[model samples]
Target: MSPDFLLLYVNDPDASAGFYGKLLDRAPLDARPGFVMFKLDSGMRLGLWGTETVKPAPNAPGGFEIGWPVGSDADVDQMADDWAARGISIIQQPETMGFGRTFTALDPDGHRLRVYQPALRP
Candidate 1:
């Protein structure tokens, strides 16, 4: 099955939603006391749910990164610059790795947000 929904456990749904809204430059599709949702331009759904309301307690944020593959190395660098200018926390500076050029940032809840350009094949 194709993965469509990506859910994140956040300390405060509204606050997290605000952060994402500003970064994505898109208003949330749904917002409530402990929940918010956004439909990304790619037709992917992103959900922010309050940690306290989760059925089972979550370990912590930042354990895994959400990888966003861009078209080129320049694209990755450009995005990194944009995010940095927007006041996003840049945990990892842009650099070329075995996979390609990449950079990482953190959300309000410390969730890893990475953008990369895949290394070209021979």
Candidate 2:
């Protein structure tokens, strides 16, 4: 089965909405004191919530993160450069690994996101 949705726990909903909205170029579909929802154009859903509202995964960093599989290595490189230019922190540069081309970046709250393109098509 395909992954259906993702939720991110944050300390501040407004700040997270501002950060994500600007990055995603869209406003949240649902907004509340403790939660926000962004309907990603990629057909997935992202839910943001206050830390107090949900239980964290055991030993997890307890935050939100997102990654998109790009079309090619060039796309990955361009995306990394573009995000870096926007002042987003690049935790890892695009590089070839066993998994294929990949890079890692962090959102405002220090959540880790890894973007990867597979080496071989399914």
Candidate 3:
């Protein structure tokens, strides 16, 4: 089966939802005190759940990153700049790597968000 949804442990779902809403340029499809969700253009759903209330409490918020891919190296750079202007914390500047040009940023909950442009395959 394919995974179409991702759930993240957050200190505050509402707040995280707002951060993600602005970053993704989309509103949450469902939002409550302990949980919030967004539907993406790729048919994927992102869910933010309150850390204090999760059944199996998570050890931390940023064990993994949510990776985003863009069309071109310029697009990756553009997005990084846009997010920086929006007051988003950019922990890494855009740089070309083995995979492509990429940058890393942190969300309110310290979750790593990586935006990249893939290098051409052989």
Candidate 4:
């Protein structure tokens, strides 16, 4: 089955929605006090839900990261600079990886955001 949505347990859904709205340069499809959702260009849904309202609360300070792929190395660098200018904490400086150029940043809730460009295949 195809993955349709990703839900992130956040301390405050409204605050997280505002942060993500600016970061993604788009408005949420559904924005409520306890929940928010954005429909990405790739047809995937990104959701934010109030942590305290959910049952069996998810572990805070999540360990996994969400990745965004760009078209080129320059795009990766540009995105890193943009995010930094927007006050998004840069956890890792832009650098080259085995796959391509990349950088890492953190969202307000400490979720890892990785931007990268894939290496060309032969």
Query: What TM-score against the true fold does each predicted structure earn?
Result: 0.92, 0.83, 0.96, 0.94
RMSD over all Cα atoms, model 2:
2.7
lDDT comparison, 1 vs 2, better candidate: 1
- Native-to-model Cα distance after best TM-score fit, residue 49 in candidate 4, in Å: 1.0
Off by over 4 Å in 1: none
Candidate 4, clashing residue pairs? none
Counted clashes in each candidate structure: 0, 0, 0, 0
Tell me how candidate 3 scores on lDDT. Answer: 0.92
- TM-score of model number 2: 0.83
For model 2 the local lDDT of residue 114 reads: 76
What is the C-alpha lDDT profile of model 2 across 29-105, one tens digit per residue?
Answer: 89987789999987888887777666553233335556788889888889889989988889899999987998998
RMSD of 3: 0.9
Runs with alpha carbons beyond 4 Å of true place in candidate 2: 1-3, 55-65
What does the lDDT read for residue 86 in candidate 3? 96
Residue 72, candidate 2: Cα error in Å is: 0.6
Over 44-66, each residue of candidate 3 has an lDDT whose tens digit, in order, gives 99999998989888888766589
C-alpha lDDT values of all predictions? 0.90, 0.80, 0.92, 0.89
The most accurate candidate by lDDT is 3
- Candidate 3's error at 118, in angstroms? 0.2
Worst 10 residues of 1 by lDDT: 57-66
* lDDT tens digits, residue span 17-71, model 1: 9899998889999998888999998899999989888778887654656888899
Clashing pairs in 1: none
In candidate 4 the C-alpha lDDT for residue 88 amounts to 91
TM-score of 3: 0.96
